[model samples]
Target: IDAMLEGFEVSKENFSTNFNGELLIITITLLSFLGLYYSAEKLTSRTSLTVSSKPLAIGLMIAIGIGLHNLGEGLAIGAAIGLGQVALSTFLIVGFALHNTTEGIAIASPLAKTKSPISKIIILGLIAGSPAIFGTWIGGFFYSPYTAIVFLSIGAGAIFQVALIILKWLYQSEQKLVQASIVSGVGVGMLIMYLTSILV
Candidate 1:
């Protein structure tokens, strides 16, 4: 099959199904997000002399990461619905809904440590939730493996940055018990996701 995209031929042989292209995109996207996060952290530290701004920025950054992650989940749910897999779509919607609730807490946990206002928490919740709905709408009409890969890559980049920032917070707290619990939580979360994948 002939596939023309942006004046370039995108064939099965030439597209990112190959290892090198996939690696390049993954590396570039991850590094770019890391760079962005690093720069933002530095710039915010320099400019934000006020106390409130920093927390708001941190909350917003976390919300963005979780939002992108949820959007990827929405894409999966939307694609399933698009493909007429009603049962699979339903299962995914329910599962993602439950998963995102935990994700919200993950987003909130750092801020919860601080004295965040109720209004800010509500805003972050909307930021994290709106993307899923938007992504589902987008996914219903468009179906492309390449597009999905891009979405997933961006989401992974953002989510990884959030994890790194949280790790730094954990280090600062100097609470061994909290760190151990985090490690245990990671193990349990991975196990659950692995088991759930088997169902699909």
Candidate 2:
């Protein structure tokens, strides 16, 4: 969602600039993110060789991924408010507040399954969720297209890495439903994001 929507704005603005090479910049930014996601996934997957603190590491990885993704969401809100799109921003806030309930499930479920301590889970929850508020503060005051582009790309990358890891985990479980679940999950997530988009 971050990459597609924000990248659209960036590409359009760049086009309006008569191809001032912002398109190139956007392309490079996206490719960089894709590369980063690939590298991170490769590195993290190698952790199967290590046993100690595996659960803690996995929990932290999920938290970091969630934080990165929400940072982009915050950027959208902050950017909209910065542009004086009050109605859009308000709708976004309302939509996001509702959407975040599901996000809370995503953040907590893996940690709970790992039997992480309650205190640690609480702390991880904070780590996973604070970025939207913080990003809003930054975006509202310091909003820049390039900045948003960079952060959004990074966030998208982090989110992809987490998804890849989760899918890999599910694959190792030898479940016949892996492909269907992945497809269904993607469809549902896209649908939700699309529904939220109507608020704008």
Candidates' TM-scores? 0.77, 0.75
Q: Which candidate is the best by TM-score?
A: 1
lDDT string, candidate 1, 1-200, tens digits: 00112102212345654445456546645774786588558845864686656656666777887787667667777888999999999888767766666577676776766787889899999998899888788779885666665666667777777776666655645656456777887777777665555443
Model 1, total clashes: 0
Model 1 lDDT-worst window of ten: 1-10
lDDT of 1 at 129: 89
Q: What is the lDDT of residue 128 in candidate 1?
A: 85
Q: Clashing residue pairs in candidate 1, if any?
A: none
- 94: Cα error in model 1, Å: 1.6
* Candidate with maximal lDDT: 2
**Predicted candidate 1: what Cα RMSD to the true structure?**
6.0
lDDT of 2 by residue, 1-200 (tens): 45556665775774566654455545644675577566555655676675533545565676777787778789889989999999989998987876666566666644444656788878877888898888898899998876776677667766766666566555654555437865786678778767876774
